[model samples]
Target: MPEPANALQRLHVHLNETRLLGSISSALYYDQNTVMPAAGAEWRGEQLALLASQIHARQSSARYAELVGEAEAELEAETKAELGPSVPTERRRNLQLVRLELERQRCLDPALVASLARAQSKGNALWQTARRHNDFPTFAPALAELIALRREQAGQLAAAEAVPRSPWEVLAQPFEPDISKTRLEELFSPLKATLPGLLEQVAAAPAQQGGLNEAAAELPEAEQESLCSELLNSWGYDPARCQRSRSAHPFSCTLGPQDFRITTRVVPGQPFSSFLATAHEWGHSLYEQGLPRSTDHYFPWPLGEATSMGVHESQSLFWECRVARGRAFAARWQPRFVAGAGGDPWGGVDGFWRALNPMRPGPTRVEADELSYGLHIVLRFELELALLEGGLPVADLPGEWNRRMVELLGLRPASDSEGCLQDIHWAEGLFGYFPSYALGHLISAQLAAAMQRQIGPIETHVAAGQERVVQQWLAAHVWPLGRAVNGEELVEQVTGERLSAAPFLSYLEAKVQQLLASAHH
Candidate 1:
């Protein structure tokens, strides 16, 4: 804990302060989404724009660039003296990531950065209002403005990218580095071919197929909150390090190194939404909490960051889908739901498990079941490509969305709120982000196979209420790696197989057969 007296130390100090500024923005964002009133939207937009400009300036400044160069030179000298030449190190990787980001930041105009931030804030505010009113027209102009600003931003960053990338790909780099359109199509092709068939099979099954969706009694909101709290406490949610709140959409946010927050919304008729969302968001927080930040130097460096949104989503899905939605988990929690409702509303444990594993399609992506979730992502992915790359008009989004829904999930949304405005990603100008949700399913399934190979089945742990065992397995294998590898490499490293959709499709198929068999009993 000595004072900084070297180039590397100075770089750490600089980055630490920069992270402080960035965290301020995160805190404001959490407040805006959670508690900010409607009248505060414009001022919030201005505040966010000002911070965006400042953060952009700091990242792209010549002073910061010089410090990075000095740090690189210093690290090289230290490595050469302490070890042999040509040896790679995590510090080296950290510097490389920082340099890449610096170049991208330098390529952008500060004015554009401010404009994009303002537009994103405005777009989010407008989207909430429009969604509540089921009025797409009110939000269409904001969406158009976000798209234009983001396109311009991508155009500016394109020159700085080492390889040629499409506008959407350029925007996606921050979320999933080194991802390409060709690779996505390769990964998604199997899902596109297989999932619809699975959906059709479920549709043709006998009564009780894919669970009795309308049979469960709805738990009161207060009961849902209490149950959700119990679920988190059981899963190692420490009140000291984390907090939960209500929001328009469920999400996880990190404000400081130790300060974590998650939000969930209770759908009146959907009794398990809050409980499952809590589990999902807690998965995200656990990963963030477990990132390699044991020291002051690590938190500010790239090596301490989550590698990709896909991998992040994988962690959340591991808890939400693999564990929370698994039969063993349902058996353990069935009594709790029953007690909360003051009656056995789901008939029995098997019926409760069926409710948790509803294998049907839906209009909203967030509430879609595991069997049809990939289809939701596929729909959004295709639409994103069209909107960003194919010049799909904003006004036509609703019409095209309904068309794709019928083709993909065989259901059309009756309102814009459930259709195009269900997600908060595009409202904030987040293009090329939906694909990660599908990728998460694939990654989670593959990683679960690997976990089972090493320790035991995840279901076994859930049955004994030993989720900490599952958490430990991930902590040792996945969390520590951080940005040491991207999403695909992390999968291959852990699972000893190249990433594919076979594991996910296999899981879904087996799940379908099990649920169908349970109906007979």
Candidate 2:
């Protein structure tokens, strides 16, 4: 064991070094999604495999474990001596978080980690091809391999953790700490029961006249990209620290402490799609920017990391649904839409809002209407859970996906590309991640309700074209919290209750009523 005096220093060096390794891996992933050529896939797989092995070895090393233990023990002595505050709360947070992560990481087989990394890189490449060719068979083998590895990972973690958990539960903990499968089912069952009825109601509504709204204008892809940039700027995205680019799918990633990059695709004939993607991705960036940072060290220490993907997704959904899709926002930005869109295809703010808050469902999860978005997540979550449990075979995924879509959303995908292969989650071995998208919607609505209670209506600020007010409010309440709180804890802290679907269901009901009344008007 190292000396106590130097253990802290050694630990800091190790943590920073590991952080750099992870940053390099993140950059590689970002490039793989955005700019890496197709022919580079095999080498990229090898590169990521090497990095994953190195990262796993470093994180799970006995020496690093000793350093963390010694560092914690030293901090404990300070707490007994009434010097805890002097040590800084963030330091304690970092210690607590890193200890948990190391414990978890140490449970995994390093070779398994490397294998999963390589498989994911290869799977992503195959998935793109499969999606393009509408061929599920091309991707199923790699996806099956990834799923098998994830199940193995979950089993390893379950055996190592204090209380044993199921395979899916263990996998879910990384994305949503301490969230039980039972708890998720409890929260999700109501939405599952109600959403179908809601969909039925919307579908039966003669006023809605569902499906894609007529094009108000056909903005060129270049024009859409320009508008997306302007939109991100207006949302207070700091261009100095962020880069906007194109990708096969829209995503946001933090590559460094100061460098956050997000991607959005411009779709021809879809005037506001790119802008909405920008706002969604910008919301993600804002959360990253506002995370707790240590003045002492600058490697995105565990304490400063976003609490969970659920919490992170809530920030994005808040901007996408609660703010950007609201009436006031539509009114304030209607002119921008009309000007950029090249005509009043949407007629007015009401029209634009209707266009966004479409009642009909879609095959693509990313482009699904706000009302049906949770259903999309529900379909994926159930399938992933079943897949992990070996209840759903990979070969049968496309059939199950289409079946669930028709059952939940009143439509079936015409092909595998629009169905099972639509999302990048399964391809990346992210089995437990789908739930976070729906969790985010629930958290966003609950937080919005709480925000209304404290800071007044969100509409007033957004209508006044003062989105910074909302951003600052989030910065104060949730953004800087990082991993200091878990998903349920954060929801309870902000909303005076644990996770619930009530707020979200209520918000949807209100939206439907508003839309119906407008149609009548």
Candidate 3:
């Protein structure tokens, strides 16, 4: 056996190489989404497939297993030594991630990995085309294929674990990890039962909409981009170290420890949409930037990665929903926002605020109002769960989505573009990722409540344009920990409570009630 120090060195080298590959792949994906021309989709798909196969092969190889084993043995020995129990917990956590990933990949056949990768690559183009035409049929074949591939992938993973639960649960493992179907039902069931009534009450309440109101103004694209850059810079983003671009959907990706990229989309009628999306994506970038910089744990491993998508979503939602949407933030920045868009500052603030917090139901999840956002996710969760468990057929998705939208939101999408084809998740075979959005909202609310307790009124700070205070608070309590703690432990550590929907529901209810009350008088 290699010496403990030698084993640790080898494992570190291996992990770093994996991180580099993963980062490079992510950079490619970001570029593909933002700047890659439509003509290059075929080549990009091939490139992504090759990279995916390489990463899977490397991760599943015996050499990687040996390195992990050596590190694990050394850590075990060190824990029993005179060095006390203070040894870095990240080391053990890194090994656990490696083992879990290895097990997951081992369950998936290499051929299936390649096929899934290729399908996803091609599906992206199909989705783009379908979305452009607002026609689901154009994208249906590719989406069906993607779903079939994901179902197979789920089965393989489940069979490898020797557990035969629902396929959605298997698919969800990558995103939520230990979350079970029963637990999801517990968290969602009450909201599902209670939200409709609450939404009705909100709709019926005398509207109190007097926040940031602005007339829809045409801001040039270049001007909007410049404003986005300025906003990011003010938020401490270094252009030399990070990049932002436009895409159909907004997302953030990290290429390395220092290199991060985020994309935003421009809505013609709503300029704040792009600005707020930029803030949200920056939140994700900041979390990536906050990972522990210790020699032992860095990137692409459990120690350096985020706890879960839910936690990641929490960070983004924290900045976007909690900080950006706060009345204080608007009060302070209303001038700049109006000046940039070349509109009346006073009129723009109130209109923009109301537009930002509009309570109306919408068809697209990303574009949905905060109040109705979870319902969008809930719809997907139900459909995806059914698709994976064989309770719903791919052919029936369009009708099913329309039916549920009406039932939940009392509105129906006029077309599939606003309905089934709105999101890229299913087309890209992302079956189990939807729930994290809702979970992120829940986590954000809980964390915000805790922040309020510690900082004494975060909304006041936000309104005063003291965003740095909130950012610094998160950097200390939430961001620096990275994957050092699991989801449940992280929630408990920061909030002193188990994860619950009460904080989120309370937050939502309070905001809606206040908005409704103001609209009346």
Model 3 lDDT tens row, 1-521: 55335787887777777777777778778887888998988888888888888888888899988888887888888888965477776677778777878888877788888888888978888898898888788788888888889889887888655455677888887788777788887888767876777777766753444443345455677777887887888889987889888898899988877788899998876767787898889988888888776566766567777878889999988888887777667666667766776776335455455556777777778776777888888888888877767567767989999998998889989888878988888878998999999888888999999998999898887666677888888889988777767776789999999999889889988887766754544
Query: Which digits, one per residue and each the tens of the lDDT, describe model 2 over residues 55-76?
Result: 9999999988988998888888
lDDT by residue (140-259, candidate 1, tens digit) is 999999999989999999999999999999998888889999999999999889989988887887555534546457789999999999999999988998999999999999998889
| Model 1 lDDT, residue 113, Cα | 97
What TM-score does structure 2 among the candidates reach? 0.96
Best by TM-score: 1
Model 3 poorest 10 in a row by lDDT: 205-214
Model 3 alpha-carbon drift over 4 Å, by segment: 1-5, 82-86, 159-165, 209-215, 340-342, 345-351
Question: How does candidate 1 score on lDDT?
Answer: 0.90
- Among residues 3 or more apart in sequence or in different chains, the pairs in candidate 2 whose N, CA or C atoms overlap within 3 Å are 216-345
Better of 2 and 3 by TM-score: 2
> Over 4 Å off in model 2, which ranges?
1-6, 82-87, 209-216, 296-298
Please give the CA lDDT of all the candidate structures.
Answer: 0.90, 0.84, 0.80
